[model samples]
Target: MATTPLRVYGGVTGSDRQAERRALFIESGLELLGSPDGEAALTVRGVCRQAGLANRYFYESFTDRDELATAVYDHVVNEIATTALDAVAVVQEPERKVRTGLARIVRLIADDPRRGRLLFSPFLSGTPLVHRRTESTRLFTQLLGTQARQVYGMQGSTRLELLSGFLVGGLAQTLTTWLDGELDATEPEVVEWCAEIFLATSEFPQQPGRTSIHVPDGSEP
Candidate 1:
């Protein structure tokens, strides 16, 4: 009989084990970075200890704490983007589309307040997170621009880009404040207000077979 190659328990391969360890480290980073205590607690040794893994495993996955923090921020932002896009895609009515997307974003923070802290906390200033946040904002602005063209046949303009940037930035600050308990509104209220803002600012032209468009100048036909 031929001798079988030795394998780890449960036949887990080295690549699988490494991936598992990397996920553990990412989760640990999220816990540390997203907590109210903030990134000060996100040291490599601290994250490895939290994941119950040794420092060697952490190094195997991330070059340093900054890399790990960037990874965590990217992971959370990707999730939010996916969720909001999915929610918006299933709706055709303008108000419903806006409400669905905005509600998904709000629910993400409400479901895990830590994510809000991680994404929007002031503590993220002067770190790799700032770059990641900028990238995320650009991505979301593009998505909003695309949605505007699709839903309302609106052409891209400098003013539209500025408006989208403003909306994304304002929404981020609003959620950060609400998550930090500075805003006393309920989750539904937050979602509704955000939806209203999106609709009001869009200033889309009114047409048949379309939902009501609120023109800021009372120019709706």
Candidate 2:
């Protein structure tokens, strides 16, 4: 097949320029949405101004603010998830793996308070962010349950589902309060506490006749 070479404008390929603009929009979206008044600052005009791009460019990558918001949220989750997995992969001991991953996630949020607000803000209204958060929780629970089986040699069961949901939902709630300054703990304190609970929950013994129990769709990895 004869393939056409990509056309470039001003020395930038079309797709490259689009991706660059999309990246700008997402970064600006993060800035606005991660702010204390993120919800109000998320309009198309606001995002365009924040990104220093034209309004048309905003529409170029995102049909609307809600779409852009989800894009930003997905970017944030993928970044943290990738780093956490990488951190865990490097440690040999299970405790060390848990601690290392927790430290990375906690430190990431600590370093960028905006990330924390975007990911775990309790004040979020009935927005796409809330809906997406629920979906992300489900996805995370699936991954966690799968990992528990691999790391702790546990079978898929209601016990695993319960613990996974508890850990994911509990951590999100705690981080939300902590980010709001309602929790008086330091970053290390929070990470250590979570790591302890994570280990404890993962290592809990299974009850008889419950090891084969399973959640519905989205429960399996």
The candidate scoring highest on TM-score is 2
Model 2: per-residue Cα lDDT over 1-221, one tens digit each: 99776579998998899899999999998999888787888899999999898898888688888999899999998888888888888788878888888899888888888888888876555488999888889988887888788788899998889999999889888888888899999989999999999998865777745457666798676
Candidate 2 TM-score, C-alpha based: 0.87
Q: Could you list the CA RMSD of all candidates, in the order they appear?
A: 7.0, 8.2
Residue 77's lDDT in candidate 1: 91
How far residue 160's Cα lies from its native spot in candidate 1, in Å, is 1.2
lDDT of 1 at 2: 100
| Count of clashing residue pairs in every prediction | 0, 0
- Scanning candidate 2 in windows of ten residues, the lowest lDDT window is 206-215
Query: Where in model 2 is the C-alpha error above 4 Å?
Result: 1-6, 208-221
> Per-prediction TM-score, please?
0.86, 0.87
Displacement of residue 104 (Cα, Å) in model 1 is 0.6
